[model samples]
Target: MEITMYDKLLQLPLFQGLCQEDFTSILEKVRFEFNKYPAGSCIAQQGKACKQLIFILQGTVYAKSIDNEHGYVLYETFDSPQVIEPYSLFGMFPQYTASYHAQTDISTVSFNKSYVLSELNKYEIFQLNYLNVISNRAQNVYRKLWDTHIGNTAEKITNFLQLRCTKPAGEKTLQIKMEDLATLIDDTRINVSKVLNKFQEEGLIQLKRKEIHIPALEKLIEQYT
Candidate 1:
């Protein structure tokens, strides 16, 4: 693929702060490689080498794996132009716990590992994006450890609920399902159920089956904090 595909990345805050002319040398090294996987096909496997940085240009992908019981848990999803790789990439290590699978017919623009690093050293903008990759991961780690195990079920429910309110153009309704939220929070569905129900009964939230709506944003955040 051509460098034109990366034009979308230019609009990002990290990339917007950059001038294309300044990074022309990097784009010369950047290339898009096409690959197709049918829906439900594993794109990258666990414990394998992650030799490329994939930015899906079309369709959807899933970061998924099974626990001891062998139930397929969808950990995360990636749409077009979104980068998908484990934390090991920044540390320049082998694969991590998760694997990526196509949730639909998909294609991506991959970066040569050496090219990416070369660009990072040559361009400050790419360097910021590189740091961003690690910063986001660190935030995720903190969210997981945030009083979750120490707090009551209601507190845990509130913690996850905060994200819905903060989402870009998010409605009171959380567009995702309880089962998915359970995996993201690393909690059992039963525990998630108990927590949600308790919060709902206390009038902290309004649960309309699959939709978890927050009616009192300020009060809810206060309680969770």
Candidate 2:
């Protein structure tokens, strides 16, 4: 394996604390499947079984969750050195909640469930790191439940984005109609537009047709949260 590939693997949450020797040993035992994807390619489909742990080594991918009943599609961007739904690999559903598409030409490395259980789980650091990742996700979702009541249109809009986002900080693009967003936040279209316009003016976001581009999602969260 290339040194750069090892470096990227080390950056992942599950492999964070492994020593060079330990990491090398594990790698030797497992056959990691490396793959490349072109921009606009569908990497994974929603509702498909998540049989492997896929780590994005390079470039960007967007996850789209469709709500057929509610008639809305939520899109969240995940950049390099991020894992795709690690918690979903062995859960009750064991399926992807969102469809993932390559936003740029991307490279990914993946290991099947069998290797994860037989090899990765044996390492104490890997086990702890995996638990931490899952625990943090659970805690985040739990905390959001208590943050249900938000003040003002601006805060509501920010809260909505924060809840749906995969990460707290990133360049985010929300693909939803103005009226639909207003409905979701329980605010009037005029009020939502006013707040969004203010955000755009402040350079916090760029409002395009049926889209709101957040240059840095953390800044919006800080301003509103």
Candidate 3:
């Protein structure tokens, strides 16, 4: 497990352009702390300040945004190797600005923001890599936001599923939920539920406890594009 995890950290694309010494430098200043959260636990609550950018080592997490009438809408799902959901390195405002929940057993390596940015700013390569990461994340999110605004609930669901779900081995399961699905597509729970019901009625999707079984993934993909 130790070898495999370190190998994963070494091979991460976000660290691709950096050198071995860079990682050593990071490890010197940044401490590796294991954060464990149970299923359905809140890792980062809504409207809170975040002091560290955590690199996911295991499990999945869902990002959500709070709303007045609808409670919370699912914003997106984040997998491992992402340092926090979105880096606040250069954001005009440094607050977390959103919340995240553990969808399953979670583990991460968190780094202090001050030390991280300090090391990153010293190196031109690291700076570019950081910029690239932030740029791509914001742009992808913007595109999704644009799509969600124009598309209906069904279209939003399609867009979200395409971005989040992976076809599991053997069985054709997508394995997400209405609640987290709400975040991924940038829609409300009420709206997501309504669309899920619509899809089930049409024999397109199967909804379960925090999981989704899609019998027609290709067809759902067809609906999007």
Candidate 4:
């Protein structure tokens, strides 16, 4: 049990920079329990009190919500070695902001809210990582809102490309397929394909079979914003 949990924790970004000795020491003092969920199950529901912080050890899950008009809206999907709803684990109203469903069979370790808060107080690295997770989540929400409300199809594709491209500067390759990219932006695949072609013709992006290479990110970003 110790060996397995230690290896799993090592994969999580929250523990990324910690040495093995430090990780072992921290785990020795913290209390956590694991659970398994079958595929197509709801892991957590919206508006429920967040008593524990769930850390995904394996499999995939999606945080989704419903709208009167749109029905089920997928906010995001997460793969293994990730934390769920770190931002909602605190504050006066510490409740899940969206429902989480297991897209595949999932294994998770949950730390009691009190246990996590206590550990955060004792470890600077953990505290920093916690803050980073929450800050990044907030920024993602802001970006999604901006893209949905203000961005046109071309701008939306460009913004999504920039976020997924993963290069600091200069040319970068996009590995996502057109269908998946369309689903991500909540747009039609035909429109996305057309936009990609337009960008290709303009020399902003080059599309190959199952790959997209951005030549001038500055030009693409200029159009995005």
Off by over 4 Å in 4: 69-72, 140-151, 156-225
| All-Cα superposition RMSD per candidate | 6.4, 1.7, 6.4, 7.8
Misplaced by over 4 Å in model 1 are: 1-4, 11-16, 69-72, 157-193, 196-225
Which stretches in model 3 have alpha-carbon errors above 4 Å? 1-5, 69-72, 75-81, 144-198, 201-222
Candidate 1 scores a C-alpha RMSD against the true structure in Å of 6.4
Ranking by lDDT: 2, 4, 3, 1
lDDT of 2 by residue, 24-130 (tens): 89889988999999999998899999999998999999998887764567677878988999989987899998999999999999999999899988999999999
Please, what is the TM-score per model? 0.64, 0.92, 0.63, 0.63
Q: List the residue pairs that clash in candidate 3.
A: 74-182, 74-183, 75-183
The prediction achieving the highest TM-score against the true structure is: 2
In the range 91-175, model 1's lDDT, one tens digit per residue, is: 6565745677888998765665776666645777667776786787667557756755546555665565543222211124454
TM-score winner, 2 or 3? 2
Candidate-wise lDDT, in order: 0.62, 0.88, 0.63, 0.73
Candidate 4 per-residue lDDT over residues 43-141, each given as its tens digit: 889889988878888898766543334222324556677777777888888998778889899998988888776764577777777788778766865
What would the per-residue lDDT of candidate 3 be over residues 84-199, giving only the tens digit for each residue? Answer: 64465346666665566787788776666686666656867767766787887667666655665458878877765554322211123444546766775677999988878887
Lowest-sum lDDT 10-residue window in model 2 = 141-150
Best by lDDT: 2
TM-score of 2: 0.92
